[model samples]
Target: MTRTTLALALAAALALAACDRGPANGAPAAAPTAGAPQAQAGQDAAAELDALYAEFWEESLRLNPLSATYIGDSRYNDQLPDTFSAEFRQRQLDFAQRWLERVRGYDVEQLEGQARLSYEIFVSSLEEQIEGERFPGWQQPLNQFYSFPSSFAMLGSGTGAQPFRTVADYDNWLARASNIPTLFDSAMANMREGMANGVVQPRVLVEKTLPQLDGLIKDDPEQTLFWRPIAEMPEDFPEAERDRLTEAYRSLIADTLMPAYRALRRFTAEEYLPAARDSHGLDALPDGEAWYAFNVRRITTTDLTPAQIHDIGLAEVERIHGEMRQVMQEVGFEGDLQAFFEYMTTDPAFTYESEEALLADYRAFEATVDARVGELFSLTPKAAFEIRPVEAFRAQSAAGGSYMRPSEDGSRPGIFYVNTYDLPTRKTWDRDALYLHEAIPGHHFQIALQQELEGIPTFRRFGGQTAYIEGWGLYAESLGRELGVYADPYTYFGRLQAELWRAIRLVVDTGLHSKGWIREQVIQYMKDNSATSDTEAVSETERYMAIPGQALAYKVGELKIKELRARAEAALGEAFDPRAFHAEVLGDGSLPLDVLEAKIDRWIAAQS
Candidate 1:
């Protein structure tokens, strides 16, 4: 599963600048003598830059309150922005331009080490934020995978990043959620504009969204997920406080939220669905080819075109198939790759009997991983994680497993949400690899550790590059054997199948967006190639359709990471330490692929 957050959709568009001077590891450089004017000047410049970074993070939090809430900042919990509005879009553009000019004023040549690195990254982030404005993503904001409506439900439902413990927390949500009607109005207006300009979502995605909104919209306010907090209200509160808060919540749902939801559902069904395009690819829209090209560059953090990525995917599919054949031979299977895939996918022995059993197996596997995770890497995050089943409302569209990072203050544990929606499709062979990817040593370790990093600017701490983040998760799956899991041939095949799936994403995602492959064609390609179930194929296919160029990040990132590992191993010979290499790769937060490569090269040089 990809990283999902309630933060602004454009949050990833902003670049991540570094904070602490020194290196990516936050290690300080030698201090210069006090009498030296150049040293004093450099220190002064670095100080000024740090101040700018702090100010930027604070301003950004106010602009995107949900971002602050996710990161454990409660300063703006009662605030909500109508991010889909034209005025808000212009404000973001203006903010990016202003920061770009401000950061660029610093003489990057005068900056040293990580200070220089931060300057470059900050500038790139601002430029990307500016460049991305050309695409008009706000025009097509609502999709099955993610949208403000869906995200708001998650926040108000009381089980997500938004806290519901304190009375203030309850009040904060009531205040924040009261803006739903306005947000929905703004979204509909933007989508209507999109409908006029041939920029609407695919019909199938919109169709899927209708059911989701239906599930959340109820006539009785008490029945909705929004009432979860009220139902589970603290007993310690005074009787009058509880009674008042309860009534307020009921009114909030009935008077504010339900009407907004109904209107959104009505607009989506009656008007938008009719105008929704039949075509699946982003390239089908106006200026779509260039838009998709930009998405490819930003999502993968590379200049590789769609064609190149498609070809790379083809080669990877072939390579991983060869490995799967080896697994088949080990198991003494007497069938071709397709038959093996069928056996792996359909055989009842691999299916979980119940959601309870599925979750139990994952919990047990977490312990299994913790037993020997020490051998692979010494560096680890302080934040702990829990394996929970995905919430029912959005499970149909959710991935098999996804990770949510821990809060900044360490109050909340990192969540690895496993989808137990279709219990039959939750295969036994798939669990280990999924756990490895989404929980231990995958997203949980990388993201939570990044959040725990000290001295980095908040942007670097919370900022994401999809290729770096998802790539590391995919790369983590490859370490199953080394981490003491993937013991059986079947489990090992699960690892190969997981990797093969990512490889297939590169092909199918690029195929749909750039190469004119339709939704059915992509789904067929997945079934033809790997051990994926029908539920998974359909869900994943629509996911790519909903969010173009995102699927490419997993394999592209994993390949880059693997390439670097190989390079480090070869250059260092026996002197290489996997733990140290892992540390160097993750010491800093998310980076653009090229920036990551350059940093790794420096590490290799240092080792030599």
Candidate 2:
């Protein structure tokens, strides 16, 4: 996930009515008005809210410089805050509270269309942030999944969101990256505090962090991942500047970056590991029950308790299993579900021979989808994306596939990173669903189109609800047949299996955190229930352990989206347009689930 996604990883989708740019083939959500008084009020309201949102975004960028860099803003590129510090935490809380009050001052009922939607999202997000301050997530910041070291590596390396186009860009990075060691020091201090408070990370996750740090901590700066910019410097640069950049980067990597990595590694292995808890779930810590509950609400953007979500997961899993069995019958597999899973996973034809072949096949799948995607999605993003393997250092702990949204300025294309680590686990059947979820019509479509939306605030464009984002990704996986993939029965099974994995996440995530399930038990449940390989099972289990309530988002979000679509179809009958319904869902950007449902209902009513 992108840094922005992780930062604002809560909420769902919402939009305006189709007649007034709300849904059904209308423009981006904008305030519509009639009469002189109403028009003036609308203008004043829009002006005030727009100004507030812009101010909030600008200050936010200053506070979160990495966010600016990711969105193609370079003004704050040379800064990195010690975000894990209590002082910084206070600043963030104050920021949220202050902004929440400002946005809430508006007469929200008087505001209509996108204006009201923006107000609700801004206020809700801020309120959630403030409410969540009671839980000290900053203290236990180092996880295998979303720690500073991993994100820093991506930014410093030439491949990620940080720009390397100009000589000044290189210099800005040098200045910015110099603060990393200080940040690492702060992280260690926070971890020490967490240790004292009985809030340390699971030892299993900390163990994984060690190898990740080792992969980057090289003796020679030139050998380091951070050295990529210097190595791949553009030939058009003047010799003097190139030489200057090369040495500066070398010094930066060796003196600053590598030492920071080593320090973090040593801290993790020697001091932190011994202090880390053996337990696997968030519920193991102090006030962990409330902490997990807050996460469950925040991640899923719903009041459905952990028990409710767990029951939903069980039902969905059983339903998907039945579907998978039918696919097995279609494929003429005589064995039971487990044996069919084994056949699909271990069959040579279902596995790729090489990383090169895996990437090539994904690229080919993109073309195949593009040819027919128009049939399903008239609402598409202008931004393009590419297929690449995950960086070697992070692939083991990374997801099977993930999408990085394109830059705001369009300098970078969206990236669909397919993990090739443990190549046999990178099943061929999995590619179609994964591609649909992570690339076209999934993240890149929702996120990039969100960024592309006119007349919305920057926060709405960049920040997101996890349920809305990942939910859309999972929902996109179901559109495979419409987009000319999932043709074979086994490939269709891959779609069901993918959905089944998410359903399993709901079970095991709740199981681990709320039900006192062990790490081994979670892994066992995944294997017993799905076609997940040992590698996927382990990594996914740890991911749930790392971020307690996140796994629930995919299933929860997907179910809501599916429900809305079904409602729209039933309401509109022959008049229903899937494309227009889709536009309504995405047109308003990521929203809270209730807001999305309400907005979709309006669109459905408009069509009816």
Candidate 3:
């Protein structure tokens, strides 16, 4: 799953900035004497850059406080911003530009290794953030899938990032929660600007968003999801404190939250929906083609054009389809490729009888794979994770599975949210590979380990490249056999099926955005190419639309990783070790694809 950020229009994990300086607001200081000798000066320059990173991180958290909550920092628990407001967007732009120039003011000649890596990535990330400003994302902040209404509901649900453990925690949320109405107004104002400027979201997307808002609106506080804290209130508080807090939450929900939800719901359904566009592709808006290209650069961290990525996706789809044919022949399927796809998706024998059974089976995969992790990985996270059903509120549009990072303080474990929305549609053959991708050696391992690395600045720990992050997840699926769970031919086919699905994404995501393929065309392409159900095809297609160019990352990333590994194996045949290669790939956390390739090449040379 892609990491969620409260950066509003900013790419969140993919965007932030850094510079030269000492630490700020309690972070470790890294500074050098101004006139030190050359060797010492370089070391000090690197150290000072680290100091800048720490300070940037501190200031960034304060600016986007909800990010702190998501990353498991509690100090900003009481903060939330109206990110949709014009003022906030301008301030964010200034923040990006200020740091971009600050970072460029430093000398890169005085840095090397990870310190240099941090500097280069930090500057690129901030530049992307500033370049992204030309695209009016704040005007269309609400996607059918990730609208603030639903995400805010999740935060208020007492089970999300907003902590509800202590009375102080509850109070923090209350203070933050009370700001919802103002934020809602700001969002509405932004949408109004979008309508005037012909930059509105598609009508179909807005239609989907309406139901999500409907779920959040309730006249009575007790009937709303906001009452979750009250229902699950901590037991330790004194009677008077409990009574007072309970009434306060009730009033907060009824007075502040419900009205906001109701207003947003009405404004969206009645006012905004009518004004939303009929066109779907970003190419339809003014400067839309360039806007999408900008998003592509920001998302993938690469210069690859739509045509190049489209061709790459096509080649991958064709190659994976040939592999699927082999799986069909091995399984002794009677008919053609489409028939085999139908069989894999439709066969009842490949499904669980109940949700409990499905969840229990996934829980069993942990031990099964853990036994063989030693074969491929020398690095493992100390952070624990558990499997959970996708919450009902967002499961319909959520991915088959997603991983939320663990809390830094060990207060919350990383969560693997498996979507059980339609259990039968979730095939038994699908689970093992999905397990590898989302939980085991996929997101959980990569993300948690990145967070756990020693002496890295907060930006490196938390920032990510989608190509590296999701690419690693897809690459991990290829390790199913190594992890000892795909001995069965059908299960191995599941691994191939997962790979095929990602390969298909490259074709369809580009088709919808750049090639003018309609939603139906994308869905039909998916049905023809992969084992995913119609439900999954439709959901995945819309997901690509919601976040254009994002689907391209998986295949582009996986191909680069696989290519690098092949080069390493060929170059250092006698000395090549899979475990060492993996450790090296994951050693410095998520990186841009080119940077990853260079790092692996360096390791191969060292081995020889």
Q: Give the TM-score of candidate 2.
A: 0.94
Candidate 1: residue 584 Cα off by (Å): 0.7
lDDT, candidate 3, at 102: 66
Best by lDDT: 1
Which 10 successive residues of model 2 have the least lDDT summed?
A: 11-20
List the candidate 1 regions with Cα displacement exceeding 4 Å: 8-40
Candidate 1 per-residue lDDT, tens place, 1-608, comes to 65535564323322222221222122233344567677576776677777678878887777767778888898888988776677777777777776766565556666777667677777777777778878877788889987567778888988888899889999999999988798789889988999999999999999999989999999999899999998998889889889989999999999999999999999999999999999999999999999999999989999999999999999999999999999999999998999999999889999898999999999998889999988888889999889889889889998999888888888889999999998888899998899989988999989988888887677788877899999999999999989889999999999999999999999999999999999999999999999988999999999999889999999999999999999999999999999999999988888889999999999999999
Error of 1 at 603 (Å): 0.9
Off by over 4 Å in 3: 4-37
* Residue-level lDDT tens digits of model 2 in 494-531: 89999999999999999999999999999999999999
TM-score of each: 0.96, 0.94, 0.96
In model 2, the clashing pairs are 10-465, 12-591, 13-591, 16-22, 17-22
- Lowest-sum lDDT 10-residue window in model 3: 6-15
Q: For candidate 3, write residues 214-325 as lDDT tens digits.
A: 7778878898888998888888878887898899999999888888888888898889999988777888888889988877776677889887888888898899888888
